[model samples]
Target: MKFSVFTASTPEWSPEQAVAELAAQGWDGIEWRVVDQPASPDGRPGFWAGNLATVPLTGLEEEVPRLRALTEAAGLDVSGVGGYAPCKQHDDVERLLAATRALGASQVRIVVPALGHVAWGGRLPTGGDYPELFAQARDDFRWVADRAAEHGVKALVELHHTTLTSSASAAMRLLDGLDPEHVGVIHDLGNLQVEGFEDHLAAFQLLGPYLAHVHVKNGAWFRDEVQGDDPLATVGWHHEWTPVNQGMHSVVEYLRTLKGHGYDGWVTLEDFSTELPLAERTAFNLAYMRRAWEEAQ
Candidate 1:
């Protein structure tokens, strides 16, 4: 299992700083966060806004070469491109794929629509029409597969919480007829703990050859409040990101399971917690993961 860092989690570092630090800290690759994020109100970098490590999508074509050169200079490979382009948007997907191919990266993330009551940018999720959303995602992915083949880049759908494809089986449903060579799935264990907790052995076995990549992180459930009255009343439960070693699921066992299954792919760290300083947290995750890998052996 090769180790990498998704720049989405390293919001404070610039692209150049990220490459140099990651290389010095012994990371194998970097997954560039490809998004056109809004500027922060106070002019400081945040995870989703004003992120310095991100590769802006507006002029990504012209920027790919410079990013590629930087990663190469730091002795890091481009593990993948982490984009927020929805799978249904062909133009956006194509734009990302073109840049990914030029950067010599094999895959780009094409997100599926949300499902639960959660919202994005103040817009409600598609909570009413499950069948419709699934059908549309399937159609969209078919087009994505065709376009990916043309570009020699594989399109990936991440199994995220509150999305149409959160679980392994659900992702498989959308990707049933599509060829794994052109399109694949990202097995994000952190997201699974929030919405789709599946047995590691079963989930991996189910994904089979379609599991092209993995995102390593950890999360746990928390109780925020308890509504009044009845014995079985609704309890406000939420999931929060935690340190890799302190989450509900065991990171060590997860890595062991992946190795046992012969998954020789990238395991990108995506810790979203804000407990430690940027550099310390980044280095800590790598060291923790390295120890886990060694202990498993």
Candidate 2:
């Protein structure tokens, strides 16, 4: 399996710094975070806001040459473009794919609209009508698949919390008539802890040909204040991102199961834990993954 680092996890690095350091660290590729970010309030980089490593959506096509040259010069591949394009928006999806193709990347991430009461990673209002949203996403993805084929790129739907296609089964339901070569799924292990937890081996077996990429991170469910002492009390649970060795998801077992399925694809690191400094976390995660990958082999 090839290893890449998703730029969203490297908020402190500039694009130049990101490629240079990733190459020096022996990473095979870099998955750019594609989005237009607001400037940091305190002039400091952050994960979700004002991330310096992110590639802006504005003038994306024009920016492609610079991006491609940087990665190529650093002896790194553009594994993928982690864009936040909403699938329902044609212009957004087109803009992303055009840039992805120009950058010599084959895959780009697209968001599946939420189907119901949303809890995470979405700005959609609560109480969305499920059936209506499902039909909309299905129609949107069909259009995306066709466009992706035209651009010679694959559109990937990520298994994210609160989204319509948060699990492999749900992703397949939406992706069902779409060609797997043009449209595929990103299996995100950490997000599964927040919503869509499934047996790794079984999920891999189910994904089969549609498993185009993987996102590795770790998270655990934590309880809010206790409401009552009843055995069946409704306690609130929240997700906290953790390091690879510190969370509920097992990186070694996940890689073992993935390898067992004969998947030799890009495994992008997206560690969101803040337990250590940015550079330390990046190096440590890479070393840990190397050890885990060898163990899996």
Candidate 3:
């Protein structure tokens, strides 16, 4: 199996720094994020880090091959390109794909707009009319699939809370008639560590066939007193980021399940642990994953 690190995890590093550090740290591939050109608000906190591992949407006619050479010299692969390409929009996909190919990546991450109550890495507010949004998203996802095929790339729909593609069944539904080769689902365990989590066996049963890649991060839920202004309001537990071995999700079991289903694709570490330094955190994450893989076998 291949191991990778999402550029978001090392926001403090430039593209060259990320490649050099990760290559020395034992990462096999990079899940590249394209946001130097500001694709959308879907760009995460990492975007603020001027020292970020990213490919710009423009100037890829020259920059892509240079970046590719730099990464190759470090003995790493440009695994995938990640950006907030909402299914509702399409005015910028050609530029995004141009950068993706220039970076020598075959996959791209697609995020559907947040429709219902969300949480953690993104928004979580009161409910919206998810059913109505779902109706629109069906057509939107199909359009994305067609576009990915036209660009000679596969779109990996990332599962996030409160989106139409959050759950296994929902993800399967969004990708139903689309060719898995042209468009697929990313089984992101970190995103799934939420209040209403899905069953592992059941989720994989539905999603395994469509799984083009996977991303993992570990964190545990903790109770935080919400000193609410409303007397009628009730408090709840929220997820807090932690190192790899200290999370709610059973990554070893998750990996074993993937292995059982013949998934040898890239497994990326998206460390959101702000408590530790980036170098220490990345080293710990990679070591934990290697140990987990050995034990899984």
Candidate 4:
């Protein structure tokens, strides 16, 4: 599989700088944010606990060509569009698809709404019971898939926390009902580790055929039981996000599995540590992932 970097971890750099750095680190491509401009110039949205949001749609018609030229100049591909679009919203889906087409991205990453309850106090609702959510998501995504197909794009549902597809089995169930040509799965190694290394591997095996993209991240389980008014809030408190080679997850095994399955896709680095400068940390993680990729090869 090829390697890429997501600009989410390095928001301070312009897209051009990010692409250049990633290419220098041996990345084949980049996943870029496609939301409207952030409320602040610094790129962090005040909402969502200081997390970055998608790039704004205004001027994207002009911006897309600019970004495409930038990546092409750097010998990198625009891997995909990374943005938050609640599939339930038709308008949001349309906007995202428009951005996807403009940016010349063949795929778009979307999140499933958060679901389930954590024993430590983090509780989320099961999306299965919320038929309307999936119904809306499916219908909207189908429409998106149709439009994307017209432009040679595919819409990928990310197997991330808080969505119906948080786990492998759950994610497969969702994919089984969709057309692989138009829709596929973005398998994340770190999210799979939430269930345990072996369990995550099992999930990967189960969904390997549908993996359209991959996220490489590492983390370790913490034994501390979080004490808080919200048990769900404590769920993340029990684990530590770490750089790719430093965590308990068997990244080597994961990459080996992908290679064994004849998976030739983008494996994007997504470690989210705030301890180091963003650009420096991205370079370090990219280097580490390259070593792992070489070893796996």
Mark the regions of model 1 whose C-alpha exceeds 4 Å error after superposition: 121-123, 126-128, 225-234
Query: Model 4, range 1-297, lDDT digits (tens) per residue?
Result: 677777666656666677777888777888886655435545453322223423455666667777778888999987888866656555676666676777777788765655533221123454345466566566666676676566666778887765666666766666676667767788888876675233645666787666788888888777866676775664543777887777887788788777767787888877676667776787787677667767876
Best by TM-score: 1
Tens digits of per-residue lDDT for model 2 on 176-250? 889999999999999898888788888888878889999999988898887667888788888899988899878
Model 1 residue 230 CA deviation (Å) reads 8.8
> In terms of TM-score, how similar is model 4 to the real structure?
0.80
Clashes of 2: 0
The C-alpha local distance difference test score for the whole of candidate 4 amounts to 0.68
lDDT minimum window of 10 residues, candidate 4 = 115-124
Q: Candidate 2: where are CA atoms >4 Å away?
A: 119-122, 226-235
* Model 4 / residue 96 / CA error / Å: 2.5
How accurate locally, in lDDT, is each candidate?
0.90, 0.90, 0.76, 0.68
Measured by C-alpha RMSD in angstroms, how accurate is candidate 1?
Answer: 1.9
Clashing pairs in 2: none
List RMSD in Å for every model shown. 1.9, 2.0, 4.0, 5.1
Tens digits of per-residue lDDT for model 1, 127-234: 657888888889999999999999999999898877888899999999988889989999998989978778988989999989999999998999977667678876
lDDT of 3 at 74: 93
lDDT of 2: 0.90
For 163-216, candidate 3 gives per-residue lDDT tens digits of 677777788877887888788888888888853258766777777568888889
